[model samples]
Target: MVTLASMEPLLPDSSRELEDLAIELTSVASRFAARLHPIMRASVGDLVRSMNCYYSNLIEGHNTLPIDIDRAMAGDFAREPEKRNLQLEARAHIEVQQLIDRGEMPYPVLSLDGICWLHGEFCRRLPDDLLLVRNPDTGEEIIMVPGQLRTRHVKVGEHIAPEPEMIEPLLARFAEAYSFKMLSKLQKIVGVGASHHRLAWIHPFFDGNGRVSRLFSHALLRDLGIGSGLWSVSRGLARNVSDYKRLLSQADQPRRGDLDGRGNLTEAGLAEFTAFFLSCCLDQVTFMEELLKPEELLNRVEVWCNEEVQMQRLPKGSWPLLREAILTGEFARSQAQALTGYQERQARTVLSSLLDCGVLTSPSSKGKVRLGFPVDIIERWLPRLYPAVR
Candidate 1:
């Protein structure tokens, strides 16, 4: 019974409040992206990707620790089968996101092809054990095909998704309605949230719809030039998970009489979800901005480095070189002596200590050194990013 018309009101009403949020998010995200050094941005982006994967997976009831994720990135898998599968799942999410971050996708993320790509790319990387989905009512074991639309009906909670036959046309309408090239910048921002709910409602795939929807939203923001991968709404959503799920379900409600606008679904509900989505994004950007504030960040690093030096874990004068890297993003190895006010040999010794501890990194033996975010230092360097590795 579902038709293309059933997915009407692709966007919520452009109330002043919604417009204000869109404008504010655009401004804040731009300022945050502009503030970081290119090298710093890259380092931060890497860490945020892991954080995004962690939080995104957490939302799906998978609890892969931050350290395990780091280990997975290093190609070190857990010994237990279940744990290893989750690690691979986490790795797959990060790899697919990296492609989106690097703009390697051939299709626009809002397009049907793009959504399938996200699903296929992520799922294809996953282990065979994770591909099977069990039907709750029938106890039928369904093997999910990567990138392929579901051939059977499915239900998520109380909501029955659109028929499998309706998915293609629904997604086609979706891509055209929220096309990035068509919407105004502010509208695109709003559409990121609106499209997010619609995609989840459609549930195009047999599994991995939640992950695909999130990845889609992330890519949409990046495409809009607002998300630099330095901040993610995943963390915010995970933190407020109850409200996040509640809002998603709320947005699925049908129209509430004539006041809810002309749509099969509720416009007021859609608007509410969009506003919550944008607010989460703005809050995350603001949180990261404060965490990366030069003075505060450097102070925290210096305090940690000084403690390590006193404890004889790091060589004396280690703070200065770290300070230099943070300030300049990266520095020549030869400048280490002058930066630390130490003799050449002593400076080299200090640099080696940092590299050995994984607090600094270089492309080659003699390449410029940039700040590194090893798991051990992440808690000190970027506290509250995730639970400390234990």
Candidate 2:
């Protein structure tokens, strides 16, 4: 019964309110990215990707711990089958996101090929046990094909997906309607939210649609030069998951009356969801900005270092070198003695202790050291970024 027209109102009606939200998000994201040093930005970005992967999976009920995610990144796996599988899944999500963050994709994120790539990349790396989806109606287990459009009809809760034959045209229309080159900068930001809902409504793939949609949105924002990898909307979404789901479901409703735009779906609902999505993004950027404020962050790190020194866990002079790294983004190995006001031998010992504890890292044996957010210390360094590892 569905046709290409079924995916109507690819974008919400433009309003001053939506434009204001988009403009504010643009300004805040730019300021946040500009404030951080390049090296520090890269380090923070790596952590945000893991945080994003954690929450994106959490949205789907996969509760992989942040510690397990770090272990998985280091090529470690659990002995038990289920736990190990979840680790692999987490690893897969992070890897794919890294590729997107690095601008390695061959097609525009809103395009058909790009969406498929997102789904395929994430799904292919998943363990075989995790690729099977069982139908609630017939109790039949279906093996979802990675990067392939669905060949059979499907239903998600109260909404049924378009017929398999309609997917290609629908997706082509979806891509055209949300093309980055066609929309103005402000419109593109709004489209990120609008496309999110439309993609979910289409249900183009058999599984992983939610993740693919989110990754698609992430890439879209990055392409717009807004997603500096410094912050993630997934954290906000996961934190207020009830409202997130409610808005998404509301946006899927049919046009209520003449007051709504002339489309099969509700324009007011789409606009409402877009507002919610942008608000979540703005909230996260603001939260990260507050967390990374230079003075506050330095104080927090210094306090943790002093506590460690008092406990004899770290050498006494560790805070000075850490302060140098925090202020300068990175520091040369030879500068450590001067920074710490210690003799070369004593400074070397202090540096070694910090490295052993995973607070400082270098690319090679003698390269410049930069801040490292090892999972164990993430709570102390960046509290509430994730739940404490207890």
Candidate 3:
């Protein structure tokens, strides 16, 4: 197993740019988590409802952007879902679940090979022969099989891939780093992200490097105590697909005079990439802040009811119940009846009217209702999602 002690930070400009970016991103996350009203303030039902709300919006986003490969990686591939990617993620999710469940400390499962396949585990078993190299049309080099249709209309360019003889020696030098055990939260996560990026820059395998990079990112979050379950960084990265590519290229691009993209890559690109990546994470923090912002929902309700209160009679004595139902996550007509201190028929009318007004929307299903698309105000805002305390 490779160990981190034997490895050095891939992008360490004496300028300390990467560290600064990491600190900024992490600080925003901590501040956001700290500022939010205690989740306990909301009932367990509300928390569950909140997730559903966010998920529904994320799904909608995915559907609208069908070809966005990165979004698909985030577990939002319901639109043109791939069975193989689903299976790999399922396997990766489950395996990590086992590690977390075991309460394993100084997690030993962070092996290099496992980390790679864990990201693209679905194709890990594919024969090496299938790992043919092809330049996509985008002028950027990408690896895929001969028969597979190029989904992205990629502009293939001259192969700028690295040789294994070169990579193997590099790996041998850091074999200990590949399987190194990470003990601390910050070190482990920072390490994981850096490691994944480095591996991709190397273009180690003929196939699945992108998938592997994503999987490693997801696993690192788990190891770092971000979320209780697998994270959806793939989705986050997918959302900024262009930035991700540009940053990766920038990080790997030859610093100067090395047109072949050989020699030590520049620190500026990685620093920018890491900073942007962290910014992406803070984006998620902002999203959580919105969900946890009690006033967000209340503000919507106030806006909806203000006019009704001004122009019309307050729905025949059902104001109180309607207010409580929307403020809380109550969707059932019967629940509204009790909350409103009104007749059952009156309560139903009030609740249905609120839904119609879009103050309290729910999915098509019954017995389950909550604030619906008010969720999307933060959907595209989703960053890496829970790097801690999911």
lDDT for model 2: 0.90
Highest lDDT: give the candidate number: 1
By summed lDDT, the worst window of 10 consecutive residues in model 3 runs over: 381-390
Q: What is the Å distance of residue 260 in model 1 from its true position?
A: 0.5
Full ranking by lDDT: 1, 2, 3
Better of 1 and 2 by lDDT: 1
Which ten residues in a row are the worst by lDDT in model 1? 381-390
Q: Measured by TM-score, how close is model 1 to the native structure?
A: 0.98
lDDT tens digits by residue: candidate 2, 1-390: 987777788889999989999999999999999999988898898999999999998999999999999999999999999999999999998999899989898887878898899989999999998899888889989998889999889998778889989898899999888884668999989998998899999999888888888888899889889964999889989998999999999998999899999999999999999999999999999999999999999999999999999999998999988888888889999998998889999999999998887789888889999988889888887889986654
Error of 1 at 36 (Å): 0.9
Q: What is the lDDT of residue 369 in candidate 2?
A: 93
Residue 94 accuracy (lDDT) in model 2: 92
Question: What local lDDT score does residue 357 receive in model 3, on the 0 to 100 scale?
Answer: 49
